[model samples]
Target: MVRHWWLILIACWSFSLSADEVTDLYESRIEVATQSRDDRQDALREAFSSVLIKVSGQRDVLERPEVSRQLSQATNYLVQYSYVTERQQLYLRAQFDEQRIEELLRRANASYWSARRPNIIFWIAQETQRGARLIGRDADSEIVPAMRRQAHQRGLPISFPLLDLTDLSNLSASDVWGRFERPVQEASRRYPSDGLVMVRVQEGDNGQGYLAQWTLIVGNTRRSGQVDTEDLNGIGMAVVDSVTDRVAAEYAVSYSETEASEFTIRIINLQDLESVLLVESLLRRLASVEQATLARYHQGTAEFRLQLIGDMRRALQALELDNRMQRVEDPWSVTASPVLEYRWLR
Candidate 1:
């Protein structure tokens, strides 16, 4: 995968994908064939490998010296495993220790891409025997399923344009194929997304393979790449690798939270004691927050004193990844300086 490390310094103003939707990301479970004992071992390694990639936002993280040394003991991390028979085949489902994985990453200083990832809207153009067409939200095209499978493997979340009246009116297949920035970016603004990805696919020389070209846009930063494969499936996998590598590089920050400073934080939208306690638990769990003590709660707003190991940036990244709470975009206050505030996303 091609990469250009760009440490993200700011959070998106708005996020479409919520925290509850991503809570299950740490649990890696894959179906394993029961054909042989070796298959079980291989499956365990594969599942752990997936966990490593998703957790670290580094495709080659499993190959890291410390991480690679543990693969032989892949099953050692497996918290539980089970066998289920379905349609003449037995499937093995495995669960690994989430805390152990996080501890390993922190020790390695790996770029931990929180499960609360950016929402990417894909505008893919495909060339067929008859013509070039845009893949839409309702598309049953080959690239859609292939991309979905690859995305699932990478634990990357992606969405397609609706191609409805609005999308078609604002942008077209030619716009994406031609890489028209203003129109494509404008079209993507309709979604609750942080970035825009455009993909163009065409048939290569007969019997050779297919060619897939792609570009990703996150604010002012943009990156593009291409892949040549025998079929669309291979191309889709390549697309996932390319996109995740770039996104991970930008957002999968390597800096771990540290405890050094203390600050008072204000939270809004806490409806009850449950919400207050939930936010408190979330804050205290972060490695950055050395201590989080509730200050007070009045009129649906809550306050806390946080002793942080690091700055708010890393802590925000981790908390945002969980999707339970997010920084307030615009805090309406009468004073010139307002307290640091986050909105509950639940």
Candidate 2:
């Protein structure tokens, strides 16, 4: 049974990778009341505002004068648009030109979080008059939809525990509600993800609202916070927003109005031509890297020189967001020869 569940998760992860690779970063959707001309115009403006927040990873990006100035002309950047209905609600799906939006951000000197984002696994425990219960992928709870909605709005990739027999045997709702990192992490080992998040939801002190306390663990950083709201959806959305802000702060690169600089990186354990192509593609996809070229190649080792729009430190930081590249620490490492070193994980 555990093996079956693991296979399903692996399949899902594979499908999501294909989706993420082709996903448009500048596309957004906004709910609208009718198909009137005024409503379409208003929806496009609001949709662009959402895109700015998602792409820049800055909640206040629309508040920037340069960015706000372009909001009135949001339709000028739209490459395509369509109307879609979901759950009987109409939405305007707008696909804006990615280059134009990035250029606007560059002019605004805003932060840019690339489409290559961290996939976080969530473990949520909700307490009520009945008792405590865990929310899984198939859980019939309002928090699930609320969390998914918020994560999608912010362009975050999030997943929930399978809560199969194997999961139930390893973890309990009490364990998550108590914020026990050890057990939560132990249970999370089966899922392939970049980060882990645990949330505990209960009635607020005022007895009329919900309180969600969450802990996020990504790399060596740990962030914890609490959100109080009048309903479950608010608590879920607020928690996701808080988590996105923290993750984006670490991964997003600030656009600088400066000339591009060169940086060299060494990656070992590249055993095939496909790995080499993938490495170069990943480097080239980063917003910080203007261009990436293979400098040299040896037996199972390759060095790539990158023309970066940002500093070397920030470029390396952005590359670290992808889990396939594992940083290799060398005691004798020097900046003059190789600025960064990593091992390509299969």
Candidate 3:
């Protein structure tokens, strides 16, 4: 009887010790999970803090303390946690950063004036013939008008008036100097111009439908040496297209570098909120975003009043809902009420 009693007591003690060991193991797991969650949260907070500083500098307008605080909190939450899948994570991050994205868009408008204004000018061509009744009637006649129209469309300022063929016929050699040269010289004198375009129609074939050969002169220099055309209209269109392309090329090359910088900065700020939110959602239940009111006080601390979508219990439950058994941890907490005493360290 004494041996049996002693055996029963030993069995009871062994069972109790085993139970205690199991309990300790469970507690240890919970503690480890809790500490892991805390560590993740800290890492997320630090990343968000760094990004927020970059955003602040990029923003053209100063952000209100409350707004900055809310953004930081949301970003921190997004960084710390993630959903079960990459797709779900993406969705949540988008939802979280929607407001900040809007703010960045507003800031991007500040770069509108950074684009260089184009310098445009109008160009006119003058042609003179010794025996022709009209001043502009040579084979090059059709081309001059086409070039003028092209310049106008390209936003170039043009001042060439269409010369009446009769005016050319009426002018003698002496009047030629007075009529074309004096007017052009006066124009150059009064207005600043890049150059003048002049064309001389040396010959024409009426049977070939105004077929002509001509020399193109730009400011006192000859450009085509000589060009022959079966149709004056075709020549005019080609010249206009060529000139416009040349001008546009010059402007584009000169401004490309400056424009690229301005465009990059503008696009980044405009998209910052969306980008951050996307990154957050990709990270998911490990992190959750809440909309919150934020304000900065005189002391430099940022106060936040967060509003979560679900109740506290629901949010807390999310932290433990993963089925993968990957990691069990309570990653985050939100105050159920609108108490504003908690402040974020910048």
Candidate 4:
């Protein structure tokens, strides 16, 4: 099983995977024991559940009454599926209908996380019988493959450091083992990522199991978790799940509105036509927004009026998740004004 994941990781690296911009959010692959009709049906249901969890960024989404009813008929939501073989293991790769999935989330009043997700860079140090070593992009270790498998399962984008001469010169195994946020964040600047994760794993008491300590840093907010399991794969899965919960809570949009509301925002620091187009595209692509139109452009600043599915607050929260813009606290604007202010970052 671990070897299968290692091969997948190598293939992903060859494609120069970027975690920030995620595609195929509505697809999932589940390992099946056999290719029989009964097994195929069961795998399809599990794959549908995985898609729901991945799309909503919530592992417990299947527990909702509406979602559970839909899951009972998971085949209705599946767009296509085919059997795939890897490492002599049979699997089902399934694609679900995106629009239907979004409607199901709205019916359940659950949060929908768009494909635009944060890219988290990880620095991991481990202690084993041999000694301490850091896992890097080029590491041929079991831990890296396990972590990558978990990240893909959760629909989270994660990157490991190159650990080349430059990285080693700036960071050490002890620095990550200590969970130092400053040095880790400083060294991670070379990689364009939205979050920083530092982890340390070692043998548990009496060498009976594995224990992992992880810290997640996104901007000013920070979170940490500890996991202990009898095997390395369990530790990796738990650590990734813990971080995904935090990130999803911060970014996912909870659907509660029956109709769209009009909202306006002003974005400054636009450099050219390309910047303006990118800003409009981002606004229109937000899960909370129904439509976006440029209302005004003056003095290199642009104002967009958006038809949002949620309230202004929720829309603003969604905007904060994208790194292309930064909220600006304009002192001249009235406190009760409905229009928000931001500065384009690119």
Evaluation by lDDT, superior candidate among 1 and 4: 4
Cα lDDT of model 1 by residue, 194-259, tens digit: 788899998888658999889999645699999888988888788888998887776665645433
Task: Identify the superior model by TM-score, candidate 2 or candidate 3.
Answer: 2
Sort by lDDT, best first: what order? 2, 4, 1, 3
**Using alpha carbons, what is the TM-score of model 2?**
0.87
Task: After superposing candidate 3 on the true structure, give the runs of residues whose Cα lies further than 4 Å from its correct spot.
Answer: 1-145, 162-187, 190-192, 202-228, 254-346
What digit string (tens of lDDT, one per residue) describes model 3 on residues 1-346? 6436533543343211111011210000000123354554454454343333222222222254443554445442341233222432321111123235334423433111101112222223323453432233232446657755544333333344234443334333333322354444443333333334333333355544332322222233333323455666666554544443443332212211222210000001112333323222212212122432222222333232333432333222232222211222234645433331211111
- Which candidate number maximizes lDDT? 2
Q: Would you list the rank order by TM-score, best first?
A: 2, 4, 1, 3
The alpha-carbon lDDT assigned to residue 218 of candidate 1 equals 68
Over 4 Å off, model 2 = 1-22, 256-262, 309-314, 330-339
The weakest ten consecutive residues by lDDT in model 2 span 13-22
Could you give me the TM-score of model 3 versus the true structure? 0.26
lDDT by residue for model 2 (1-346), tens: 6436533543343212432332656888989999999999999999889888999987988888999899999988999999999999999999998889889998998988888887889999999787889999999888889999998989888889999999999989999999899999999989877789999999977688999999999877799999899998898899999999998887777885476689789999999866776777778778788877777888999988899875776677667777778988867856544467899997
lDDT of each: 0.75, 0.85, 0.32, 0.83
The TM-scores of all predictions, comma-separated, are 0.76, 0.87, 0.26, 0.84
With a 3 Å backbone cut-off (N, CA, C), the pairs that clash in candidate 2 are: none
* Residue 324 lDDT, candidate 1, scale 0-100: 58
Can you list the residue pairs that collide in candidate 1? 19-323, 258-309, 258-310, 259-308, 259-309, 260-308, 260-309
Query: Which candidate comes out best when scored by TM-score?
Result: 2
